[model samples]
Target: MHRLYVEEITETDGLIRLSGQNAHYLTNVLRQREGDNVLLFDSSGQVFDATITDAGAKEVVLKLTLQYRPKEEQSVAIVLCQGLIKGTKMDYVVEKATECGVSEIIPFYSTRCQFTETRKLARWNKIAIEASRQSQRVTVPVIKAPVSFSDLLSMIKNQTDSRSYIFYEKGGTSLKSQVLPDDIKTIYTIVGSEGGFSPQEISEAEATGVTALYLGSRVLRSETASLASVLLLQFMFGDMVYS
Candidate 1:
């Protein structure tokens, strides 16, 4: 069954109002009719089986039938602080980041970023939402607007309690060497734009607790690094052990 995220869901009432593009999806694209089953999530960490009761221009009504175990969320809350990139590259980052189990994605502007602030942020959020639904993730990773390099540094300074790591080509240590306690609940990973972070910016980040670590010897694109970090982190601490 297809998955959909709704803002509000009621267990007792057993109904959900699907709106926006999703309505268009069910009505036209999927050609779903009354009694067709689909999965619904409220972003509250639960999955409910629902069937369409009605479909209309603005919204679709779903009747909840069964509720299953809450979808498995990442045990480690990793935030991907990615530098703004051009066009669909950011979209690819958002989609892959969610699938690999990132808790949130922060789109911040760096010195060498190509796109303007308004353009990239707008598109990144939509990509995140769609990816979360497609992956059956209970929570959609929050995609924050693009902030400046200086502003990011200040925010990092304020986040003294959280563990932060930056993927840098010149890094001396491997990201795998960062010892995350079994009980560690959250982590923050930063990946730079195509040109990578400036030396001054890297130093500033270090001052605010963002330790630089190399993914490998070779330089990778921002999207590739973002996905690689998330997957590696998950394998280190998450269910990737089964594989």
Candidate 2:
């Protein structure tokens, strides 16, 4: 069965209208007809069992038969702060990070960043939405606009009750070796762009109480580091382990 994301699904047992691209997707792309059944989800953490009551060129109507909230969401408060890596690579990182249950994704520009101009967030949000839907998560990770290295540091200084971890390519303590502070509610993981963080930048990050975490011996690409760190953190401190 096809799964669709709708903006607003208000009623548990009433007609819900899907217009514009959604309607085109159903009538033209999926070729769904009346009597077809599909799953519908909304940003409100609600899922609906819907049947196609009517299909037309402009819109489609679904009669929602059942509506229920999903299971409790992943409890981790990991925020992935990545250095801008340009184009599609950044998109891939956002998708993977969302699937891994990151609460937010921040792509910042550092000294070695390929480009500094912030990209529009429409595409990234779509990727997160699809990723969240596929991963069976009710909420999508918040994709933040790109910020400068200094700006990010300032943001770090302002964050109260949160621990910041900057993944340095140079020697630093491994992520697994550090224990999460019991008092903090959020964890920020910062990974560099293609050229990686410069020495002075790393020093400044550490001077401001950010822990420099090194991931083993091999030098991973920027995208790889961002995605891998999220999974590792999720497993160690997040909701990956059911037991």
- lDDT of each model, Cα atoms only? 0.79, 0.85
156 Cα displacement, candidate 2 (Å): 3.0
Compose the digit string of candidate 2's lDDT tens values, residues 4-121: 8776676644888888999998889888999999888877778888999999889798998877768676554899999988778988998888888998888799889978876568
Q: Can you give the lDDT of residue 240 in candidate 1? A: 56
For residues 65-144, what per-residue lDDT tens digits would candidate 1 score against the true structure?
A: 88898857666688888888777788888889887778888888887887547655666667777888887678888878
Model 2, position 153, has a per-residue lDDT of 83
TM-score of candidate 2 on Cα atoms, chains taken together: 0.91
What is the lDDT for 25 in model 1?
83
lDDT value, candidate 1, whole model: 0.79
**In each prediction, how many residue pairs overlap at the backbone (N, C-alpha, C within less than 3 A)?**
0, 0
